[model samples]
Target: MTSIEHITLEVADPTAARTFYSTAFGLDAQVRLRASEAPTTGFRGFTLSLTVSQPSTVDSLVATALAAGATTLKPASKSLWGYGGSVQAPDGTIWKIATSAKKDTGPATRAIDEIVLLLGVADVTASKRFYVDRGLAVGKSFGSKYVEFAAESSPVKLALYKRRALAKDAGVPADGTGSHRIALGCDAPSFTDPDGFAWEAASLTPSA
Candidate 1:
């Protein structure tokens, strides 16, 4: 019953990363944590925590990556997106470095949780039945092809549409580039809609 608490991104520089994420994603820079304010345990909201690496460590990381054949694509720079940087792994995998400015204020005290994943499917009725038959409880209808499924304390919403239509809405090529599945938590079974988009459920476990 492990739940996903938050997502963290390691950045080359803290101050630059913070400024970039705040500007690019429209995230607020309300919370700032000093070294003493690090968390001990439990769930917290989506937060951007910064740790300044020692000079030697930073140099070693960059050297080791380059020696192993990583290409420096975007050298670290202070941009509108903050201090942005990227490197291309030997296999052509691009790694981006940026700081996120979101904070997780812990779990919701009220009855509901926030929407974690948005799933798009080809057929609404068929997709709804797939989840319902699998023991997921369906809530009120969201729209023509959208429905809500309650997963214990967590809530999952599914949006149905043609594959092409969804791609158009997202402004990404429908060519099936990138990932077909998105993970939820550690133990939760992965789910995919009729159109092939995958979704994972995030919730508070018993321990939390």
Candidate 2:
């Protein structure tokens, strides 16, 4: 099955972005950066999720992000689904750090268990079909609302969500245009999805 190897975010300053990511998340290989002056505004049609083991880890990561110049979109807190919060990086990418466990299992560590890339699409059904035809396997489905793909051996998991709902979840407005300012690096051949998300064949991306 096709799997995401890493995600590349087009930023205005790759050097600063690399420093921010390294200091905040200590990410090296999983997230890559490229210099781009692409005009993008408001919500960028997607959010990267960092899933950890417990609430304390969520809090720790969030704090580190804030210290690394990430502004808070939503303060970390407990919810029905667990604990999570949204933060916008200095480069304007939204990241949601969360965990299913509401309580701390142990001491806090910045170990991220999973990285999920959620695309906000206009039509979930149509997008699902687009990916399924491209050799992606659906791991979870909830009718026309949401779908999660089984990305085997990938550093990132892929999922689809309705644009408006996704924006609300990310604590941002639904309106956005110009560029997604992001691209997915996957094992499959290059293709652009219906919503204009560009995916390319997996390749090694050096840290900026």
Candidate 3:
């Protein structure tokens, strides 16, 4: 199975982008590269390098956005966090584009280090049992339906919730259908719960 490796975001500048992310999410920048010096292909650290489009194309896109009354918070700059930058849209949305740090390659020694994903399900108790029966250990349960599953050594937590309720809390439409699939790793087994939520189980390895 293929585990979720990383998440990437696109932004206007890299330097200013790193600052915004560092301040907002406490995310550390791992690498920085200029538009001219960025690789044309392949992955850099954990994040895949971005493709630099032409200046005229970028300018036109920016101008069009500005014409629509978009405000620019930080113009753009190269910083410690690799490519892309940060911008605040007129609607107050803050965006950042930068290389995500590679997962630490150190030994697994922490009690908890990361949260993989939260799943929305129709029934919580049923879902928890489904996972528990499949070899996952159920942690503290919040009431009857809300629960968290602790994956051994990965610092990843599997969260189960009511679908419509979760969607409402997230300010999104409660139209999501079917179970979401989460890939684990090679040699580890994968299982889908009652509500159709899928998870892959495997031993942890040092990330780079």
Best by lDDT: 2
Native RMSD of candidate 1 (Å)? 15.2
Better candidate number, 2 or 3, judged by TM-score? 2
lDDT (10s digit) by residue, model 2, range 60-122: 899999999999999999999999999999999999999999899799998999999999999
Give me candidate 3's TM-score against the actual structure.
Answer: 0.41
In the range 1-208, model 3's lDDT, one tens digit per residue, is 2233222233335455455444333344222211222222211111111212332322333344355444443343343543333333332233322323223233322121243355667778887777666666766788765787664553334567676655543334456332121223323465545654333343442211
Tens digits of per-residue lDDT for model 1, 38-147: 22221111111121122222233444446555567555444443433444443222333332212223431111113233344656678777766756666656555566
Name the lDDT value of residue 95 in candidate 3. Answer: 31
C-alpha lDDT score of every prediction, in listed order: 0.38, 0.92, 0.40
Candidate number of the best TM-score:
2
| lDDT: worst 10-residue window of model 1 | 42-51
TM-score of 2: 0.97
Better of 1 and 2 by TM-score: 2
Question: By descending lDDT, how would the candidates be arranged?
Answer: 2, 3, 1
- TM-scores of the candidates are 0.36, 0.97, 0.41
